[model samples]
Target: MVLLKNYISLRDQAEIVRICHILGVGPGGLQRPGYSTGHKLQLHRTCFGRNWNQETKCQERYNRDGSIPPLVPPELVSLIVTSVQDARSHVNSHDELPLMSPDTALVNFYTATGRLGLHQDRDESPYSIRRGLPVVSFSIGDTSEFLFGHSRDEDKLKNVLLESGDILIFGGRSRLIFHGVRTIFPNSAPPSLLQKLKLKPGRLNLTFRQF
Candidate 1:
């Protein structure tokens, strides 16, 4: 079963598939970072596209050129902004996700035997720029161990199981909360999603921001 409703959850398999497919269309599009024990710390500080200069805990950009599509997509920006219009209906509602206005979505992928460590997404300016705004994150594919911490300190973290089709939104007091993926249960995916991703052990994370 899934846990960690505040930051992650199991979502609609079909819609998750569609989003994953569409994510690759961008030039410096989404990424499937080869996971390693360092993945969590590495990605937490990694920067993508054109925003590296600003990240406090930066990581290598997914693209070879270290460039990415804009933090905010011009054409689909509006649609993405409105994507969470009904967010309030969900567990982590819109009213709490203030950054929903300038929604920027970043896709990160993890493959077999991959694991991510505990960390926080405090690099994006939105977390501080738009006060009290929460970042909306979506997870699909194989299950993984998720951790949430009150701060960067080791003693404050809590672990949870994150399954396919999960949606996580952290805002308000939880906005700056520390979180990250620990380990991916490789080869444990549902056959259909595995097929969608070519039957590999992996999970795609899409984070929405209001930039």
Candidate 2:
């Protein structure tokens, strides 16, 4: 895992929040197949590329009803891809980084009590999964206690504090690690960040993947 602290500036963070607000936020219910009702997170999701199917672990251009929306904005994809390459280059000079392009994004809004269950990001295509393409995640707003483990055993988990403007990249051997948020620190977001974004007390995480 490559953790970049304070990687995004306040100005950029504000812009991202603004865009998300314009796009929309919600209580993204169990819209994907195989997910039981009420098993979904109380967060919003703005998808890009073909929508991801949690059940099939694949991307489809249309939903079961045959509807399609625009893919993630090109500018946003480029911004993240550039940052990932830069970080990868600095961390492993001998290894060549894959040409990463984000085809999907999950923008999650977590209130003070919201937390994600331990899960692996294994929804990408077979080729990308085989290559172990990294998932680039951006954190904004309140801090979170992120937990990760090779297995589901809680005793084996390692914890990390993910603060606002932090970026996390995990792939290769560590790509399939089980990870989730343990807690979100209440009222921990920077005043400027909340005010500029006009968001209530909560944390916002944008995770970009190759799908």
Candidate 3:
């Protein structure tokens, strides 16, 4: 539940968009599970050292199976991991943050009408779960109404507005909390950002996790 507002600058945001374009971030780029046909959001995924299978919903160290692409650039991974660790250290000196080296990323695109249902990120390996690694999430483009609840009760959900350039880090006691994107605000993106990235009205989210 730790939020860093405007954590990334406009220049950095545009750079990330460029990188995503180079890496590919559409239907043909990363294939989601066939069962996700009914889902509203579109997703593009990339792995660092490990790859996740949406169909089987499992993660494994990458191999030459040709099913998944290679890991994201090391520089990008370092930027995210370093930022989260530094932020956590500033909050509590003895917070016992896990030594996190993110190996997977889920890039999700949401239109004004797109929404993500409440869910927990519990697919990491047992070792990762035991260590309680944090999930680092970044937002670009439109703003979103993010819902998070301690349990599965929708009535107890707390709402938060996630704007472009915002970063969210949840772990430790807050890890595994039920969370989802309730809705997206149309035309909420920075005009310069949309033009620079040549994007339509939508939000792009990048979540980093360890496996």
Candidate 4:
């Protein structure tokens, strides 16, 4: 796993947030995802290019409202490409990191009290998992306490602060590492970003994958 601090520029951050806001007001917009057992997650989510149905535990082209999901914007795709390159460059692990062409993106918003339990993103195709297709994550809005470890043992996990504009990527040997968000620090967003985007007191995260 690699974490790039302040990887996204302020202008790009605003643009991405703007795009999310536009898509989120529509029929297939941001809504809380729940499991088949009727347990709702702590975040609001929407998808681009493909919708991940939490109940079915699979990807769907149409959302719960019977609307096609918004396509993954070209600009965001370019950003993911560059982010992967930069991440590989940072760790000098180009050979270990496979090239990624993200066709689906999960855009999630977390309130101040929101928290996700430790879990692995293992729902993608087995071939994708075997090839180590990376999950490129972008963070904006408030800072969050990110917990990640190889095992589910909480006491042995390591914690890091994921601030706005941070990009975290994990692939290859680290692709299926257990991870979760512990908490959000209220009023921790950059003043400039808050003023420009007028986002709520929470965290905005977008994770891209090939699906």
For all candidates, the clash counts are 24, 2, 1, 0
Candidate number that wins on TM-score, 2 or 4: 4
RMSD of 1: 5.8
Return the TM-score for candidate 2, rounded to 2 decimals: 0.86
**Number of clashing pairs, model 1?**
24
lDDT of 4 at 74: 96
TM-score of each model, paired residue for residue = 0.65, 0.86, 0.85, 0.95
User: Candidate 3, residues 1-211: lDDT per residue as tens digits?
Assistant: 5788888889989887777666554323533323546642344344444555555665554322444555766866877877776667645643545557887877677778877878898888787777778888989999999999899897798999999999888877677889999889999998989888887688888888887
Preferred candidate (TM-score higher): 2 or 3: 2
When sorted by lDDT, best at the front, the candidate numbers are 4, 2, 3, 1
Better of 3 and 4 by TM-score: 4
The residue pairs in collision within model 2 are 48-72, 49-71
lDDT of 2 by residue, 98-183 (tens): 55788887767788988888999887788777877788889999999999989999999999999999988887767788999989
Model 3 global lDDT (CA atoms, 0 to 1): 0.74
lDDT of 4 by residue, 12-95 (tens): 999999999999998789898887688999999998877787656655665477778877899999999998988888666676
By lDDT, the best candidate is: 4
| Local error of candidate 3 at residue 99 (angstroms) | 3.9
lDDT of 2: 0.75
What's the lDDT for candidate 4?
0.89
Error at 102, model 1, angstroms: 4.4
